[model samples]
Target: MDYQIARHNMVENQVRANKVTDPLVIAAMEEVPRELFLPESKKGVAYVDEDISIGNGRYAIEPMVIARMMQIAEIETTDVALVIGAGFGYSSALLSRVAETVVAIESDATMVEKAEKILQDNNYDNVIVVEGDVVAGYPKQSPYNVIMFDGAVAEVPEAILAQLAEGGRLLAVVREAHKVGVARLYEREHGVIGHRDLFDANVPYLPGFEPVESFVF
Candidate 1:
């Protein structure tokens, strides 16, 4: 398969055509070999304009959705980023291009191992894939300039928000069961965190982020 051509077409046809205007995000998407991040069986469909399951209920979300989220976050070249639910570390790879340093958290041991190998092999030196609970957020390196959830979640925990540096931004697709998801951005300023909806998305939810069930009496 001609991956370079397919990548170009993906950027022009799916991402750029969908209002993802940030040049940095566009360039990262164009440069990163997204196919390398997918299972071999799924690589042929890597550039399709839809989420590709990566097992354990996670996904490498649609390119346009991630691009729009990055654009909305306004990532800076010197910023430190934390990617929750790193999966195959694709999002972290994209971020490594634009951010100074990236810490990606994944709960699955096998995934962490594979993601680390792929990032290291590809020379994405700025990214560090760590195995840990995704919901906990990596507080050891708190006050991150940007925090991105790699998949949809039912809610954003305050603990995660607390890790945001003043003036930092966190982006996630917030979706409740049987409800539509909205891409939301949370920003911290003057010690206050405020969030606003960016766009609607129906991406899959990351494990351990599902809403707790309530039982009717």
Candidate 2:
């Protein structure tokens, strides 16, 4: 499959056609070899308009969703980023192109190892893959300029929000009742975090980010 051509079409059709106007994002999507991040069995469908599952409860979060998230974050060249659930490191590779440094956190040790190796083999020097609890947010690298959750979550942990630097931003798809979800962009300004819903999205939930069970008597 002419992967380059497929990448181009994904950017032009799925991303740009959906209103993602960031040139850098368009370029990153066009440049990144998304097939490399998927298992051999899934590579053929890398550029398709659906989320590709890489097993173990993780999905690559469709290309357009990623493009829109990056567009909303407004990543700057000087920014430091944290990617939660960095499955296969595809998103981290993209962020490495836009941010000064990227810390990608994964709870699964095997995924951490695999993603780190792939990103390094591909020359994503600015990204650091770490093994950690997804909800914990790597505090050692706290105060990130941008933070992104690769999949949907029921709520953004307060600790993770605290890790955002002043004027920093974060993005995620908040899954609500009846399986509905809203993509939201959150910004920290003067120590307060404010968010605005951007669009509708539906993706696999990041493991351990499920909503707390309510008591029903």
Candidate 3:
């Protein structure tokens, strides 16, 4: 069996079950080659309805979770997007279909190199994969209309909030211990307003974003 049939089944059953009705996201999952982002051994697991292990204890976000975040972000063709933990650039490629330009950042050098190669090979010129610890957010390319964290995090840092353009939105799956929840946060005029609990699901945690420290007596 090929990934095409599996991917389609995934979109219809798993993704649609999670309320991912965006036609664009569904189409991307069907057309984009998910296996191309995996190692040979894990190629068979590409359409397995879960994260693809990419080494360093990291994994790409499940397709349905990505679709959930992207759908709530309400992507626009002209919006500039910042994708944290780009893995092998699959999300960046999909985001490029909606966002005008995509800044795909990964803290791992090997993943960065691999993402760049994959993107170049696929002719994804609108995306730039950077190697850096910009998990909080990439400042050099600040003021993005959309910021999507492919993995779950304990908190959304101000560094990432600062990167959002006025009225821009940041979408992430936040983990509080055993719980995992999705949020779509907007940078409002005075402050940020988040509409959390879009759904409850499991996603791998992003590195470098552990919970903030608290004072002790």
Q: In each prediction, how many residue pairs overlap at the backbone (N, C-alpha, C within less than 3 A)?
A: 0, 0, 0
TM-score: the better of candidates 1 and 2:
1
Which residue pairs clash within candidate 3?
none
Tens digit per residue, CA lDDT, model 1, 110-167: 9999899999999999998989988999999988999999999999998999999999
Residue 8 in candidate 1, Cα distance off native in Å: 0.8
Candidates sorted on lDDT, descending: 1, 2, 3
Off by over 4 Å in 1: none
lDDT of 2 by residue, 1-217 (tens): 9999989898888999999999888889988999999999998899999888999988998989999999989999999999999889999999889999999999999999999899989899999999999899999988899999999999999999999999999999999645688899999998899999999999878988877777779
Candidate 1 Cα lDDT to native: 0.94
- Model 2, runs deviating above 4 Å: none
Runs off by more than 4 Å, candidate 3: 190-195, 212-217
Model 3 per-residue lDDT tens digits across residues 107-198: 98998999999889988899999888865578998889899887788877777878888778888888766455555455545456544467
Candidate 1 TM-score to native:
0.98
Per-candidate Cα lDDT values, in order, are 0.94, 0.92, 0.81
Global Cα RMSD, each model:
0.8, 1.0, 2.2
Model 2 vs truth, CA RMSD: 1.0
